[model samples]
Target: MNLANTLAAFPLAVRKFNPRLLVHSPVMFTVFIGSLVCTLVSIQQLVQGSPVAVFSALVTVWLWLTVLFGNLSEAIAEGRGKAQADSLRAARTSVMARRRLAGPGGPGTFTEELVPGTELAVGDIVVCEAGDLIPSDGDVIEGLASVDESAITGESAPVIRESGGDRSSVTGGTMVLSDKIAVRITAASGKTFLDRMIALVEGSTRQRTPNEIALNVLLASLTIVFVVCVMALAPMANFANALPTPVVLVALLVCLIPTTIGALVPAIGIAGMDRLIQRNVLATSGRAVETAGDITTLLLDKTGTITYGNRRAVEFGPADGVAPFRLIAAARLSSLADETPEGRSIVDLALEQGDGQPAQAPEELSADVEVIEFSAVTRMSGLNLPPGYPANPGTRVLEVRKGAAAAVERYALERGGFVPQELEEKVLEISATGGTPLLVATFDGTRAQVLGVIHLADVVKPGMKERVAQLRAMGIRTVMITGDNKITAGAIAGEAGVDDFVAEATPEDKLAVIKREQEAGRLVAMTGDGTNDAPALAAADVGVAMNSGTSAAKEAANMVDLDSDPTKLIDVVGIGKQLLITRGSLTTFSVANDVAKYFAIVPALFAATFPGLGLLNIMGLHSPESAILSAVIFNAIIIVLLVPLALRGVKYRAVSAAKALSRNLLIYGLGGVIAPFIGIKLLDLVVALIPTIA
Candidate 1:
């Protein structure tokens, strides 16, 4: 929309007419060939002193203008990307990075050495501290920090970036706001992710989408049909004793073919990519954006994608015969080495309820203990303490375990402990309400104790119900997939308003779900950020990866969300639907424009040969010359008038495809057929006033 960019388009528009470029568009090149022939004929007629030579020259002028206008529409679309690309280029400035220097002994030393960011190679180590820009896209090998991703996400809020797991990768150009991190550059020079994003947004790397190519094939066939129809008309006119001039026949051919949509197709595509960039999503290909529109099933993970994702422990409930204070102490001990947000929350919650001086940070329990990590298979983890503790063990190392109720119950029975019926009822009560209940129990040498359950609660994100409603309106089924128990998953699915759900799903289940949907002829889209999600992400029709996720997930995904907001998928679906609708509407308009041209030029060209044909001129256009000139002018100017609508795309409403199609057909379809007739008539009246046009 910038005036400067619009002005810059003029030169680019002119260059687009180069024969090499024009040749690629079969429909447009056919028009160009006709225009070229009209030019040669008009020049010859002018030198011959023919009485109707002026009209021929005028017809030739309008033909070239038609081609130029089409070029201008695409150039303007490309220009918007050029302007944005320039801004992104400004952020990619070369700067010095603190490269890690090796110690003479080994890879032990990380002494700093300065090197240009552009010169840094893959596998080279670099360190960045607070207020420093991350030199390249890489994984954090050591340390933790908060990073400002505003350079990409445009959000001012800082996000945590820590070593280990899904949240460790940092993008080039993002700033570290606190602490320091040592990163191993994962991308080579000139091949960074940002460079690819820049190319994509600019549409420099764009290949025609499958649908677009198919549309082009149809359009080309239509053009060929129109050409043959126009050519056959010349012989029919000759047989009727009044053959029209070559210019008029050529004009008829150009008008009948669908040039309006052809001119604007490239522009519609470029603008779609620009819209994605504005939304802070980076799509590797236009095909992904288009595929998103056609998705019938949306597979979303419950953690992060549906709920707030950081599950927090809210309360501890003691089993019958277990002391409340004893349960809290055991719960605290169980989560000591569990660094997951839920585990940390349990430790913090226990400290808050303990009868002691309130501390800002919970102290680690002092004991010689071996940490047992939780696994998706076992669903349990806790500490193995060699008890000099519970004060003097007989011979066994006391084991304190916490996990899913089923897992913990099995563990208890093997150690001579039993879960009280009250505790089992309590776990069921928590699960029914959509809370995960981790059963905490301890086993000493002689006796095993069933302590209690820790309740982990997660909040469903706000506005989710409304967004799900929008998806329903669009006829897209929202399916929530999760590893949570069935009751918990169902409760959350109902609360969130998702259309369907899959509970207790493993990584394999996620892939199986997508495959089933696809096999049923449904296109599926899913959002994920974990390395475990890579295969499912790759299998889905459209995979949207969170920027805060691991590099493996980001690499597998075709689209990346810079804001790391799972709910932003709604905005993405909207943009994708808009792109397809815009193209469809314009193609309808382009075809409709031909009806008016058919009425305006055909009758005027043949009226003299068949006197009764003049009755077809409903507008009472002054002469054959005026009719052809007016229609040509209208055709050239309409492309310009339509540039804004094509770029902004049709206004999207979250209605069913049938309703949306009906609404747009009435507007763009019916309106396109009617408006051109009125416009050509108004222009014919103006042409009648021009003495030279006669």
Candidate 2:
């Protein structure tokens, strides 16, 4: 085993006597007294008789004590390291395996043994049975099933998967729900979609946060101080007879050093991470949590972040002087074959608005008509009526419900019909208030028939604006990225009070925007919930994926939010900042405590050298055993006190880096100085309260 690993595996009691532990000044002081006690006893025994046995017995006892304590401390550190490793491994295990079926002639039978370069023919059933892992990335050829993609996406719910030509694609590692699926492997084993996701999650482990590096440096520097203190004090105390034996001095030094360092720091970090988990936020990488506190920019997906993703139709308009019932019937008839939310809403409104019983089926109308499907890019739905409808001669009406006021206005202007000025004004007003207004019109060649406007609005999530304000208060710039046009994006951004907006952005465009922002040296935190956002989320400095988001997005993000609340970003940033501060405070106190131990030990070493100076006697006032006990107890107590602080999380306010640094210094430095005195004094009181020493 390596030195660090070996020390960690050692028993706690044995580790207490490790040379590294005793190297601290406080421990060395204790060892100096222990050696003095040993030598004085040995000399007395020699003067009396049986010098050989007496010397041998004393040496054996001293060596046994040293080894026992050293091994004890080593064991404690080792156990803690092992536990941390176990937690990390558990996190890795959460990545589910992807599996695919193979024929007898195929490269592998079982999914577990499948290699990267395996090939398969078309129509071959790649079965993904219940509880079976997905083996490769492929489109579902058959079967309807739900996949539990939480591990991959951070989403808590299971997603339904169905087979079709181009619409359904299954990733590796997703659990098959009800029925088995036959998939044609699109990507080979290691190159599958799940494999890439696993690679991404695994890659996060390599990136260490600034806090972790700082703690490591602090520990290394303290270790050096500890070793130097032991080396310088051992001989000086031995020559002056302050410590009668060198072995006692060495043992004390070993106990003191490791007690303060190896045992304390890791404990604080582990506890802090556990606390963060309890807050419903999983920080896949420690660095992510660290960076969250310092994030200066937050890029949000507009659809699901600030606004409820579902779109609902709220208003319908028909031409004046025309019966409202006729308009309703036409809209219902035209929308019957459509399944989009807007179409469904119109059909429902027609049914509700009609005076008598609603038409049981749209196909029964027998009206010769033309239907145009709504496309995301065009943002419109259209229907053309034939002369057969309404059973009246010379009646032709074209019904259109289109998104974006600008597109509809242009279409109307081209038709030589000016949209009423009041209608245009109303549309602008609604758009400004964050409502998506769709213009519904009915026209028959000659004089245009203006159907009343239909307004469909995406619901605003409560408290979203307040959360955006909080992020801003913390100095995080909020940018809204959406596929919606300029008007819709602007309206939402204004309502949400976002700092900036990027409209008409596709998934690829979003990625480009993120890259541009990154090039500007901004630490961007991207929040998203769809597969389209995977690249951008991955490219961000800190990717926060919602629990309800697509598996791809979740896989790409460094952190997952169970609540999926955009406002939770505020909480995350707060927790991250507090974690860094807590860790910094703990490390600072640990090192400062080592410095105090040196002060307590160094002055005493010289007290006996000059009787007039009274250095050696002053040093002898407290035995090495007492000093070692005091240091170990103090170190352990500090760790215990810090547990609650990490659990509670530090209260952080948004401030400049300078202010933050200054505040942290004051809290850590002042706390470090005062903690030991109070801790040691309490120990002394408790010791005094005891009946007697053995």
Candidate 3:
């Protein structure tokens, strides 16, 4: 945290000591009660000039400091979150929207009224043109545009948002860079994506995860056991003719309980979210963050997650009798009006082949040319050329189609055209190698002929194999889910180095995989960016949605990756595991240090009454008062010293769980039992110099 945030959190730390609030953490609250009792007893002793008044007062002061230090750790963590929230809030500035009038007027039918963005409500249609700020979170209902979403995703590269697909969702506060789109706002004012992100980082809505709740219960139970043991000591000490002071009993109790972990638990959890924000991810709940730590199987979509989503034309395979030039010209002419990545790739590949003079641009084509966009039902797209066109000077209009081999073949057959036997073999050959075959055909109203096949190669993203290897090293199995056939899916999965593959999987299939893994008692994580993925996203133990995904997908998922990077789950899992490891390590140290405190205080409490107890004073402290005071001071100071570790979290190593456990036990456990002995004994040497205590 910066100086400004730390300073702001200080008062908040003090205010959190309110009894009503402190009561929620049973262990810390017990320390609070002990501090209160010691405060009252010290005041009474000082008034009556009791011999041990100074010692009682010193113990009382340290006990209070112990509790305050714990509060400071949590406040500082929260302070960091508030700082992030303020910056996010700045992006939610007001802008004017061109509200569209709801009528049959279609695309350009706007009301001519510039309404403030905050005035827009859900289902209101707003038109966003080049250089205009998108009014609110919504889906593109008309047209398409290149939008600058750096304000939300922190990515300077613009992304495409178009109608009728998974890439349609647009966030408010993002700027439209090119073209115009009519957006039907999906969220009301103050309920935008930006608003939700601000709330998440502010941590006002953070709830404890299940594991954290269980750990808290365990700590409370240990506190109660220690309380009973300390209370029983009072009667035992009295019988020995050496009754310990109430302040002494209070100090012993505070040091003996698991105060260290109790104080840092909230800080550790908050720091986990802060780390996720640094990675440009927003988690809706702390439970999701913790669940990420336990994920054993990760289900990933093949297109974007494993391989680059864009399928590009790599080669051309012609029909047996057609000339290569004839096939290239037909493919180029059909794709000129198509705007998809694959279509654009076909045009680029055709031009690179250099068959003839540069082809005419889509705009230069005659106005009679009709552009037929691809649809799920048709599974094909092409241009319907008018008769006497430059490429088709025949008396009848020409239908130039390029799409799925089956769709184009069916179109050719209906017009009395037969699929070339050789071309069918070429389609199967491409599919076997994980390439999509787009059959190109031409029909002049009377005769139809299959022209060629465009081989669309799916490129596996770079470094995918290494990422899959890293997940495997962490004992997580990576499974690739794809709609591609088994042969194609296997090729991509092998190239990506994932452990498993699911072919021809639907949205329901994705959900079933999550349930099956969960039934086997393994936590699962998955990523998605479409409405079809909403069910699987919600079903997975840890669901991460891309910021560019539809509102339904984003709402169902627990985490949102603002940069829309599907591979970010790897880093997220590491951050989550670090959070759990930090808590576990600190808890080991906390419980271990109690071993030293017990030896230091127990021997001093009865050494004079029972001479044999001196044998247990291994540190051989100057006196009973100095030994007790030294341990109390060490216990209180350790909390302040550990605040940084709690906030920064422990560095996680991707080793097996057993190796990690063994390593942590060797370090924190052994170190915990040893460090306090040295620290308390050193403190004893200084405490012995005090004339009153000596």
Candidate 4:
């Protein structure tokens, strides 16, 4: 923050003293009322020609300073976010969109005209060509392209955005790279992804954390008790034949209330969210950030969370006694119509290894062929062709199947073929190395045989094991869930160093795992980017969704990772723990400081009336006037000094919670009671030098 920005907050600080806001902080509200009373008393004393007129004016001035310092702490925290919001808003400039027009037929034609992006409406078709910026959040409906998501994700590499897949959705403000695409805009003007992201990071709609509300209630109760204690003191002084003045009672109440922590609580909450925005993560509410600190178990999917999700075909091996060229043709034929990255990789691997004979183009197949899609339930996906067109349209038409090993074995056996021992051994060898072995088979009217296996390789994300170790040190357990076979899941779980693993998991199995953990009285945090993971994401205590994930997964989550890195949860958890610890340490210090303030002021108030009360002034403050001014100055100045500490949290050490609490208590609780005495005595020495006041 610059000097100009810091000075800009004075107006906001003064404006926050409205009746609505003051009521939220009961301690500050009570002090506000006391300041008003002191103002009225000072004016009355000046009119009556009182002996201590100057002292009354000084007390009233310092009381208002106490409240203003509290408001300044909050305004400083909110200013940091407003500056970042301005920068993000600058990146969302409106541009011209190419409106795709329909021909005499329907919404499929592609002759378009340019118009401002702000003029685009929901469900409207727009054309985005190479080097063009995507005007709004939408899905591609016509062509394929590579999109640079650096505007939102901060990644330099471009990602593919095609018409009919999980990755088709494109965010506004990103640039296109390869080919033209017709997109149907899902959001209208002023409501794009960048707009929501800007709103979330700016903290305009933030709700209070649960811990904050509970602490406010406790502080309000304490304020009421202190109010009653101050009201009874006039009667006690009357019994001593000398009544205390109204300004003296107000000063005592201000010092006794827990104003230090009460002032800094909101600042701490806003700063926590600001820190998350700097780290390129968006939290929907402050409550979710607090929950990250309490998470006991973390449930993560195998793909994209622990390992890179791009499972590609790395090697192709033919079965014993089968020609390599024949097996390569079948693998390519089955994957021709498959749109998944895995399937396209298989086709690419086969095409690179053709023999001397000219290879058959997969597009040359006749109209009788039909494409079968992959499914979780069947555990297989391939072609289903009718006979007489290529092979036999009557009984079988050269069905090429590829899927899990057991699924392919059952398909071959039902067609009167047996699984060879060599094929089984190859599948085991591929799986034990953490590679997914997809079995390819052929079924015809006269024969049924296993062709070969395609080895799909996926790597564990770099540095993920170290991040998992950090979670373990925080006392959180990790579990890996995937649809791969048991052997493949075990290999990944061991390599990732997770605590447990569940293999061959379906969508229902993912939900069941989360429910089982919740039943064991553990708070679970899940990270996922797939549509199937949406249900479990909603069931977990904290669900951090990837920005590259589908809309269903993003909508179900409480937090979103703009960088799409799963390791960011470690930073989020540490931030949550720091927020809780900061609040606790300040609360302890605020209460502890009162013990020293009372010793400085009580004897000074009574020593002139009863000389025997001088024994209580252990620090030997100069006089009643100097003592009162010193105590009030120290009370107000401490709020200003702690503002920086509140903005940047206290230093956090990864250790046991008990040990952490003990160290903070020694610093804040013990030091708070002693520091104020030294500060007040130093100020009293200066006040005594003023001949008019002494």
Candidate 5:
């Protein structure tokens, strides 16, 4: 632990000593009562000049430390988040917005006004330029620009925010680096995502997760059982002629209860959220983080999540008797002026074939050349070169095109050209291999002929197979949803190692898949970015939306990945399981610690009256007073020792739940039983040296 953090949290820990706040935790509150009772007994003994006064006062001080140490652990976890919230608050200061005035010519047509960002509301249009901070959370309505989101995400690299698509949403406090854009505000004034994140990290909006609540109930019940047992011990002690002092009885009761786990529960929960924040993920509720551990079915979107979303040209298959170079040349020429990802890939592949030589830039094309953009209706994109343009010196115009197999073949057939018989076979082979077949063709005035096929594929992301296997090992079934043919989806799924897949799925189908999985009693998690994904994102148990996704998707999801990584759900799941494991392990250690305490204090309390009980005192301490004081001191000191572990959380491994349980039990449970024996005996040796206890 940093010395600065400990010093800062001490005051906050002191503030948490109020009974109104302490009463919420039943076990800790019982300890608080025991501390007060011991304090009074110590005062009574001191006034009467009893030699036991010093021993009683030391026990009283340690009991109070036990409660304070618990508060300090929780305060340390909260302080980390409070510091982050303060930084976010600074960035959230009101800025000047270039609000576009609605004039007679309509919105964004004429003038602008400088208004406070806080004054802006939903549907208000604002213009942002280079070096200007984005005024508020909104969707870019017009233009495009490079935005620096360092203030919000802590990443210095600039990202592009443009009109339309998944990357349209812009956050306030992010600076516009280049170009200009008209943004239509989507969030209300004090209700931005930043405000929500600030509240979450500050611990104000945190609520106890179901697992935490259930564990609390169990701890309370155990505390009650121990309380009855301690009361019964008093009568038994009197009957045996070995009545213990009031302070000794209180010390024994405090040591026997499960104080270790009771004190660290809040710290464990808070630290879980802190881990997520450090990973650049913002979960709306602690419940979502907890639920991630229980997710049995992971419904992942095929595009951008499992695969790299876009299909790129990887190979060129020429028609029989046609040179490979001819096919590559035609593919490159048709895609030179094309701006689409597929088109750029084609040019790149062509260059790779030529030993990485640079090709003619798109801007180098003459004015006579025209670019034919691809559309749903045409299903093809190409270039039309007029005569005497570039390397062509013919009288007739040359038209080069590349697109879907059927679309390009139909174009050749209509233009008095024919598709080669072998080209059809080539297309099927590519399709069977899960690659898109784009036919490249050329026409000069009257005659047209098919050149070859371009093999484009949506490549599966690297390490997906290993990642899926890890999830499988943890008993999670991976399902992929895609809008492709069954053959394509199956090929990709096989390569990615997913357990199942939904082919040719639509938005409704995606939602139905999530609902069906949930109906079968499985927790489903999915990631999406488009407006069409909103319903499904909301329906899934753990919905993680990409930061680059549209506003609708971000609003509907329960968690947001600030870095826009689709696979971050894996880390979230790991963190959630770690939180549960940490809580369970500490609970085991706390209960096992009681085993050693019982041996140290129980025998000393009765061994004087019942000689046979002396065998239980294996530690062989000097006296009953020394044994009781040592157990009390150990109980208080252990809370402070485990504070760092509670705030940092237990390490999580991607394994089955049974395996994790066994591992934790072996380490924390068995170790817990042995640790306190050594600790208590060591403390006894030290306490015996003190004249009052001896």
Candidate 6:
């Protein structure tokens, strides 16, 4: 096929669209039209026996070839991507299930093809197993098994399931693990959870941000400028009888209106995302890297992101008369049956303290006269003991341990005996230092004994303090948000060096806080790892989720850290700054190159009669062919040099706003001016070394 016809046919065949080709940049179309005009002028001159017409025809032909090649390259690349996606979709379909018989006498197998809303009968086995995708959404009728839910949830964890009733739902594409199960189809193939998840991912891919649209617009504008410049100058040159002027103008248009700019822009973004992958971070949106650097506030979840997220009992104090070991034994036994993280921590600490052996089971503990289960409102649990062997008989004391400092203290004051002011002061002091204080109280129906305190602390991550300092240095405010009580949250925030702390914050509260920060003109970055944290993560300017986090968190976050290290935030921010600088530098240099083309080609076109203007043209740079060759070579070299810059990011710090703007303008703007002279000199030297045809 001819070049124009091939370019037109390619996109339709591949199901791809190029907006640039559709709108038809007037400037570029003008350049093409100008070349056609020059060809006509050259033909007229040839008929009139003018030698200059031959050179003009050559230049016109060269420009057409260049434009043709550029368009063809773009069509091929786009076609390859579309073909690959189509192939993947086909492969996915092939692996999907088709109807099969479940044996004779079992619902009487029929040849009727099933569609959406097809009712499934009981005892009909859907026949799904490991790696064999389920054909439809269903509920388990019989058997028990585990299923891999990675495809739907983005969580690689396997979930165990047991057959019961209508509430048990199974998704298509999930892999069955271990035992096989009979599932009665609830929803047909197209309406399953898997279908919905697939739709969400596909929809996400289609949603482009404003920045991406702006970049595309800029590229389109440049293309138009290149085309217009060529069209305007080509006819004027024909009137001057300038030899090779039209050919050189055609070549200049091809070189200046680089079609690759549009193609390469997306390629650069993809490459940046690849770099993030190497660092064990997944960038959900291609533009996230750019957005991350602009963040002014960082909101971190207190549990996993700041503290170790695991609780461990660290300190113990007994009542004045009670022995320390006795209190420990009672606490250990009380925690034995508890599965909460705090209870486990207490039991584990007690075991370790008593020579690495767990406390005897709850059944083995001294008979409890009365037991108070943990209550969220009261924040305490207790076992009331009857006065026995050695102690006073009327002292029917309740041994209690609770989470919150204020609640425990208020309970102590209401049922007071010995105030234990010293103990209370010590516990409050520890709480302020970021330790979780558990109040151990003994109450005898009316009066309460203020027993000693038990402190459980979340382990601090190594280098956490230094990392927080680095964030502060970068002018990014760091805040801790958690569901933990005020004392525990404040304690961890202090130890982690966070600038602010919000305690007892729910998912909605976190979202509100983020919105508030944004309203104050801060770009907020939030890190979270819970289903509850999904809304806040989505609301933030940039959301970073741990790879080990809940599926909802990962799906909502802009970035995921595969290593689950919060410190990678620093590395990502650095990469974002580098990308911005690199893009800025490339754009400045590209525009400057176009400006230089105007200087080189315009003067040479008016050179024949305007002798003084011709004098302005450098020797050996008289023809459009030479200028076309120079511009193309220069463009290629600039793109090549940019490869290393993109790969190895620029080194930058979180500096004052003024300093940052000054540095960027100087490095990108001024640097663009200096680079071309050096590049041109190098190119001249290379050209001089090559042997020329006579």
Top-scoring candidate (lDDT): 3
Please provide, for model 1 over 1-694, each residue's C-alpha lDDT reduced to its tens digit, 9 standing for 90 to 100: 5577778898988898898988767777888899999999888988998776887788788889888888888888877777557766766767789999877777675477899999999999899999888888899989999998866676889998888878988888888999999998989877877787778867778877888889889989998898889888998877776537888888878878888888888888877877888778888888988888888899888888788999999999998776787788778777877888998888789888982323222234454667788997888998788856542122353888899999999888888888999989999899888889999888886667788999999888888898899899888999999988899999899999999999989889999999999999999999988889899999998999999988889999999998888877778888888999999999888887888888888788789978899888877888888898888888888888999998898888888778877887898888888988899989988888878676
lDDT of 6 by residue, 1-694 (tens): 2355445535552332243552333333434555577678768878988655555555566444433333343343233234323332332232334343554656755333342233443333465555665555666666767876554444577775456521245655567876777666655445543443333222224333356567767777776776676677666677777633545665566556643344344434544554565576767665687787677888877666677777778877665776776557656644655656888778777667662444555565456445566776888765656665122222454454444556667877877755476777877777777777777666667776655677877777888888888788778899888777687677788888999989988778899999999999998988776667789888888888765455557668888775567657767876766566555555555555555555555565566667777655553462544444455455445544554443344566667768866776677556655565456545545544433300
Measured by TM-score, how close is model 3 to the native structure? 0.93
lDDT of each: 0.84, 0.58, 0.88, 0.83, 0.88, 0.60
Order the candidate numbers by lDDT, best to worst: 3, 5, 1, 4, 6, 2
RMSD of 6: 8.2
- Please give the lDDT score for candidate 3: 0.88
User: Over the stretch 1-694, how does candidate 2's per-residue lDDT look in tens digits?
Assistant: 2456435545554434545554432333343345455566556656777424333343435434443433343343334334434433333333333335454766755443332224433333466678766655566767867777665444667766666422356655566766777666666535554443343233322344566667556555655575687677766677786743444444346434534433444434443444445555556666787787677788887876778866776766544565666555655655665766667776787677662435434455455656666666666666666654562212665444444566666666667665666567767766666667766555566545444466678877888888888778778898888877688789889888899999988888878877887788888887776677789889988888765555566668887764566556667777777776666665555556655555344444444564443442222324333443444445555544553454355667666667877877677766666666666545545533433210
lDDT of 4 by residue, 533-633 (tens): 78988898898887776666777889888787776777888888788888888888888988888987777667788999888898889998888878888
Assess candidate 2 and give its lDDT.
Answer: 0.58
Best candidate (score: TM-score): 3
Higher-ranked by lDDT: 2 or 4:
4
Taking all chains together, each candidate's TM-score versus the true structure is 0.90, 0.70, 0.93, 0.84, 0.92, 0.70
Q: What is the lDDT of residue 109 in candidate 3?
A: 47
What ordering of candidates by TM-score runs from best to worst?
A: 3, 5, 1, 4, 2, 6
Segments of candidate 1 deviating more than 4 angstroms: 1-5, 44-54, 97-103, 106-115, 235-243, 321-340, 343-356, 360-402, 442-446, 654-657
| Steric collisions counted per model | 0, 56, 0, 5, 0, 6
